[model samples]
Target chain A: MGELRLMKGNEALAEAAVRAGSDGYFGYPITPQSEVIEYLMAEKPFERTGMVVLQAESEVAAINMLYGGGGTGKKVMTSSSSPGISLMQEGLSYMAGAEIPCIVANIVRGGPGLGDIQPAQSDYFQSVKGGGHGDYRLPVLAPASVQEMSDFVPISYDLAFKYRTPVLIVSDGLIGQMMEKVELFDQMPRITDKEINEKYPWATNGKPKGKERRILTSLDLDPHKLEKHNFHLQDKYKQIEANEVRYELIDCDDAEYIIVAYGSSSRISQKAIQLARAEGIKVGILRLITLWPFPKKPIDELVIKGIKGFLAVEMSAGQMVEDVKLTVRERTKVEHFGRYGGVIHSPEEVLEALKTKIIGG
Target chain B: MSEIAIQDIIKPENLVYEKTKLMTDKTLSYCPGCGHGTTHRLIMEVIEELGQENETIGVAPVGCSVLAYEFMNVDMQEAAHGRAPAVATAIKRLWPKKVVFTYQGDGDLAAIGTAETIHACNRGEQIVIVFINNGIYGMTGGQMAPTTLPGMKTATSPYGRDIATMGNPLKITELVAQLPGTYYVTRHSVHTAAAARKAKRAIKKAFQNQLDGKPGLSFVEVVSNCNSGWKMEPVQSNIWMEENMFPYYELGDIKVDGKLLSK
Candidate 1:
């Protein structure tokens, strides 16, 4: 319970993690996401709340550290940018396969390779789908504003623990760098030693009983066992798909056209929605909050309602749009528009696209 | 009165586990010849001997050992493929009194995880590292590994592990011993009873080093064999590992600080 204060999205994310009773943070300082570590370093949450914060050698190490921390059922997380996240793929895959609960925040920058420090949403597919190898999905949350960064951090932690799976808080350079007012939640008291002992009977701290030895590995020499594990993971993924979809609708009740967007791109689309309304154009905005869950229900509802078409605005060339199209099932036309690399589209740019495709103004 | 006293006898079975009896009811999926099973047993022995069954924290890595947390009867953490060192570093640093260790495979420790592993050694993080070197990626269908010897064949290296193309083999035990933070470094194969017994001793000291307050990074390499990946009978694979593998990778404590055992 605190008053609203100006903060960067990444910084708010760090503070939110501490407030969520996170026990450890392992991260490499990459641009855009660098502020996340800077906030942790300056605040020293480890000393106050018994949190372990370390600036790892590389993104690879940071993600691995998260693997270790999450494996033991400790609230652990790591934050990075595009290139750094790519390095964490192996660890992420293992975390998913091992069923270790942890949080990962990717403050995406534009990149096919070494793109730029600027904002880019090209990592949409990577975040929503399995960013790493193997058949699994990391539950991904996309924050539209600085406030959502703080809000989503705790939500991601809760989801990770509840499902006993990994969760991704995926933002872009724009949201990470932009400053906005965020309300800091009251820090919750950490679980006592007694509670941890009773709660995590599955975690291995090392004593062997007649009960089988516990292993946090993803490997199985036996094909039958491996298949069984994969099937279990597939079940979890389906459950997440069924349960976790979320989105925001603006002016859609009277909207003749719907604009689909997410992350930083959604913010720009909000402006387009306002401008179109002023000109008496019944244009609405559908901003996706959970990227992996992909806001399918609201989208399908709109498609069935006979909404003319959607202009998919994203920082990537076109990733989420494909999902939108597939989910819409050819019911409505979905036009794609985006920019790759470090360049982010302006509100005017989105408005221009809307004017041509939706308004004909 | 004539009945046997229930509590008087030193019931080795009675001292079964610890306060944090964090064990999952999951059966192991390791193959008959996989080194993961034996190495895991050796660790349990050390845990039992030290009487730190509950207070100890085990860090599992990304390879075959990733699910180690599920089978070990203790509080466990899972580290990324090679990030076990860093995770162990943080866990130990945050909870200085707790015993922490990392269990990793060759691909996890020597390949992508090398950066974190080396840095953790350099930092002298007071933790134990049980390095399992099976020379191939058993989990990923027998792909090449960092420790895959020159001329060895794997799925990725269809012809053989060509030095010019695949790069030099990684030696973590030797590489880690060079770090000042390292208190003990030893390489032992699990093919024979002799080697497995010696391995138990090496691992025990590694844990003892942490308990003594002289925080150090200890490395214990268990040269294990993967049956499914090698496509050989368990017995034949063990023999092959002894004759061909042991020569290049000699077994013994390369470094130790406490009571000296004659080489």
Candidate 2:
């Protein structure tokens, strides 16, 4: 429908940020995600759409820049890798507490501590669970293909402003580096300063004539007031869980076994499903798009349909499996399988893992 | 003398000095003799005098002035400890027409936020940075700061600061002045009435540089005293500062219009 082009996942996302009418992007270069800022620099979106792009000194500074820009009711974003994201945790917590809307994308790399520049899904718990401190959760979107990578930018900003909360788009080194065909969205215009004041009355742009000045801060010395603010945040999370859960059920009906996965793992499992079906194993795939509001209802319906077992495929040492097991609750056998620490598993490997871990054990 | 009317004294023409309306009615959280209240008042007064009260945004730091948003009535955002410069960088970059400034303390501007302060200055960001150098962290109960003078005792340095172990005090204003991205850099103190007037002039010039669309960052550092932290009376502390602090962190203009002043 729109303009089509072959682009790397990181580059597509960069271009999409400009097309989405982002007001500013502040990021630091990191492996597997450095292309994001590099691409933005080469494209010069500022000249084209009046967007502002800056390379921050560190991830710590970059995240705070998001806080500053987003507090002014502008659409702002940042991208980083695993170790870099770890450094941003403090800023993320502050932004969440202050209820600033922004988007952060993590092109995951293998890590406990600078593990490797290879793809890994080990950050599942960190992304779905609160990566930052305090009682907060970011809406996590796991994109499998480069198309989804480009498409998730505007979706992330929408959800960010809609809920006045931070949103995380989780991809990995594979999707970030690989080149694929992407359909770019039409260009959207950046909001004017007047529009910003009109839309976000709470924004700290400046005090308008005769209007009360605004203040944005997370520091509440009184425990009672802080507790009340926490309750308000909890209510928002509940609304997101109710309305924003997204997943895909591929050939799940009449399936004796279902392979649960997300991001690149889901694509691998899709191939593994064909191999198992060819051997008359009656296997299917359950691909998750939204990792936070972990699609429990559909999995429950499948459990009621009398599915035999589940294979939680990943590229890590089993993180999302806990969520799957929690949802299944021993009603069906759920097992985890993957090659961790930057090792990519093949379709045959996934099929062999399902047979050994779930079908036999 | 006994029968003078209160109304006559409060009359508009009779008033020599009036508090700026830009400051909110909230009571300042700073201690009675602390310089933070005076510095806050001076900044608001500058904005009011420039007639840019509705066109400026301020970033407050995490020291005793963390609640600066409550006192400054204009639009404000509170930054994390030491990240006020980074936050102000984004705000000024995004809204180039608006006047942006950051108010920070010694521990926040010189210690934990050293990288942010250095890099923002290096980038020549069009913003004003107000640094309060009190040589100790006053918010979290008087911990040693990066600006702490040698032999000065603090909560962390109970037996006096050992420069051999703790390192020499950082002259951040002089450090930033050497950077090519800074348009104006100066150091002053607000411990006396005349000194306070001079500090206010520097603060006004810093804001004026940004208003004129200067090509680089403007920085103003005010060497203040923390009497409670120093374990001295207000008057004694100011006198001690004059005798001890003035010799080391000497006052007056360090840089003017992008040129460093030779000692």
What is the C-alpha lDDT profile of model 2 across A294-355, one tens digit per residue?
89998999999999999999999999999999999999999999789888889999999889
Model 1: per-residue Cα lDDT over B56-165, one tens digit each: 88887777767887677776665655677877876676567779988899898898778888999888888898998888998889999988888888999989999998
For model 1 the local lDDT of residue B229 reads: 81
Among the numbered candidates, top TM-score falls to 2
Cα lDDT tens digits, model 1, A1-361, are 6868899999999999889898889888899889988999899997779888888888777777776667666788888999999988888898888888889998999888998899998998888789889998989999999999998978898889777788998898889999999998889776665565477765554443454445567776689999999999999988988988888897899888988988888888888778878878788889888888778889888987889888899998999889988888888678888988988788777878887765563
TM-score of 1: 0.82
- Backbone clash pairs for candidate 2 read none
lDDT of 1: 0.82
lDDT, model 1, position A44: 92
Where model 1 places Cα greater than 4 Å from the true spot, the runs are A207-212, A221-225, B1-42, B57-97, B103-108, B132-171, B187-199, B222-254, B258-263
Q: Interface RMSD (Å) of model 2?
A: 0.6
